[model samples]
Target: MRLEFVENGPIRLEGGRFRVRVGEREEVLEKPRLSLCRCGASANKPFCDGTHKRIGFQAPGGVLEVEGD
Candidate 1:
């Protein structure tokens, strides 16, 4: 299982449990791949629900590269 932050998209969760909490509400998803909406415009809440595409949710606005040995 891995979690990856894309350049111009939501947080990608793969092969693991995806969980989120906001205020008194919490959500846990057990999908293979999911894009979490960070733009806070998703009607589906914890899930991306294609809101990022509608509102044009940009990434962190930087270049990030990770290398492992």
Candidate 2:
């Protein structure tokens, strides 16, 4: 599998099968691609519902620098 973080947006995942687990619910995805939320503004929890664009979220793509790192 491959993951690409979009600039100032959701995380893009594409490739083979993968699993998504939330609480007691687990699901296996066979789709070619998926979008995951990073802005914490998605009404749909782990999935991307384009709320980041609506909320004007800002984040850097590629390598992320942690404050204490």
Candidate 3:
């Protein structure tokens, strides 16, 4: 299982437990691969609906600093 932040795109979660809850709703993934929204433009919350491209969303930095195992 791994989380990879693509170069200026959504974070991809592969072969991992993809569980997310926002308010009263929750998302459950049945696939081994999933792209999570980071640009905050996805119509599907917690999931990438490809809205970032239309909105031209950009992360301030190109690097992601993660500290966990």
Compared with the true structure, all predictions reach lDDT values of 0.70, 0.85, 0.75
Tally clashes: model 1. Answer: 0
Query: Residues 3-65, candidate 3, lDDT per residue (tens digit)?
Result: 777766788777646677799988776788888898987888688988878888776434344
**Once superposed on the true structure, which residue ranges of model 3 sit more than 4 Å away at CA?**
60-69
Candidate 2 segments exceeding 4 Å error: 63-69
Where's the lowest-lDDT run of ten residues in candidate 1? 59-68
Which consecutive 10 residues in model 2 have the weakest lDDT in total?
Answer: 60-69
Model 1 lDDT tens row, 1-69: 556776656777676576768889888877778776778898876677877777777876333344567
Best of the candidates, lDDT: 2
Segments in model 1 whose C-alpha atoms lie over 4 Å from true places: 17-29, 61-69
- lDDT ranking from best candidate downward: 2, 3, 1
Superposed by TM-score, candidate 1 places the C-alpha of residue 38 at a distance from the truth, in angstroms, of: 1.2
Candidate 2 vs candidate 3, lDDT winner: 2
lDDT for model 3, please.
Answer: 0.75
Instruction: Please name the candidate that would achieve the greatest TM-score relative to the true structure.
Output: 2
